[model samples]
Target chain A: ETAVFQTPNYHVTQVGNEVSFNCKQTLGHDTMYWYKQDSKKLLKIMFSYNNKQLIVNETVPRRFSPQSSDKAHLNLRIKSVEPEDSAVYLCASSRTGTEVFFGKGTRLTVV
Target chain B: GQQVQQSPASLVLQEGENAELQCNFSSTATQLQWFYQSPGGSLVSLLSNPSGTKHTGRLTSTTVTKERRSSLHISSSQTTDSGTYLCAIAASGSWQLIFGSGTQLTVMP
Candidate 1:
């Protein structure tokens, strides 16, 4: 029973190349988030959107941004990705103050 | 700064044994959830207990908001249960969840 979904399970690109990941949730959650899990398996929130509005923005790099066309859809875009951008990007959703569900995550590798 | 710390970074247990994992946070959490990381690196939500105790299958999670800590108990360990357990806390008035370093569990058959 997969609810939250992310596209491109694995991706590889050059340092200067641009990459984008798409995510969608069927749980009808009000809040969606993007988290970066580094090689050390440390998860950190990068962006949070509530009902299509950006609510929380962490100290992520300028090349990273989140786009939401609606409450159910959230996308992550990295412009001119750097080698350090290689990590697992996970998309999640929650009904405000409740348990959060996660997607399978997209693994990005920048050479 | 909001933080989450887990004890006994790694645990190894034989099948049919039990395991206890702990999570301590720095702030008053509006929400506390536990997750299991799969071999594929995806997170699977196991339990969400803001306070008190909650149970699902053989897993139990207890959180004491006043003390700002939570504990997860696995009654019967299995080889399939081997993975990383993550604890996340959403600080008061925030939707962003700060995650702990995670506890790696290895159950041997």
Candidate 2:
């Protein structure tokens, strides 16, 4: 069983459309993060949420937003998706700097 | 921005052989963690070594914080050990982690 779950393992959509990915963790971790893995398999942090605040990576576009309804869930929304936005988005959670558990990741493709 | 660099982008090792991966950081780090990602899947935590050396099973990790370098040693490699190994470090005063591109290792039987 997966402690961290992601919905819609794969998504294919048209350009200029909106998309959202959902992630949930049962580990009871206070901090959650979103990472983007490019075609070259390079992983980069997009955003991190802990309790009351969300920290966005400087390189993230303004159209990308992270929403956390509660501690166990973090959702990523992209507006006016572009072809460059196609990648695998992974969700991870950890307590402090300890071990992190990652979801299987949702692959997004824009056409 | 802090940078994490891993050496030998890809490595091939025979079964029962020993392998070592290295990671170097650009800035002072408070936490250093290693992870393994299987082919086409999610990542799993391997070890968290901020300083000194740690051993688990056939894997051992040693981190020399002052030198800003860390190494992961795998003994008696098996085909199941073929995967990408990642190194992530949390720079001092920052809660976010910076990850290395990773070292892809293939252990052949």
DockQ values per model: 0.92, 0.76
Residues forming the 10-long window of minimal summed lDDT in candidate 2 chain A: A93-102
Q: After superposing candidate 1, which stretches have Cα over 4 Å from the reference?
A: none
Native-to-model Cα distance after best TM-score fit, residue A60 in candidate 1, in Å: 0.4
- Candidate 2's displacement at residue A9, Å, is 0.8
lDDT of candidate 2 over B71-103, digit per residue (tens) = 999999999999999999998976677899999
For candidate 1, what is the DockQ-based docking class? high
Candidate 1 collision pairs: none
Candidate 2 error regions (>4 Å): none
- B77 Cα displacement, candidate 2 (Å): 0.4
Worst 10 residues of 1 chain B by lDDT: B37-46
lDDT of 2 by residue, A8-76 (tens): 899999999999999999999999999999999899999989976888999999989988999999999
Superposed by TM-score, candidate 1 places the C-alpha of residue B41 at a distance from the truth, in angstroms, of: 3.2
Candidate 1 lDDT score at position B81: 96
CA lDDT, every prediction?
Answer: 0.93, 0.93
TM-score of each: 0.98, 0.97
Q: What is the lDDT of residue A3 in candidate 1?
A: 100
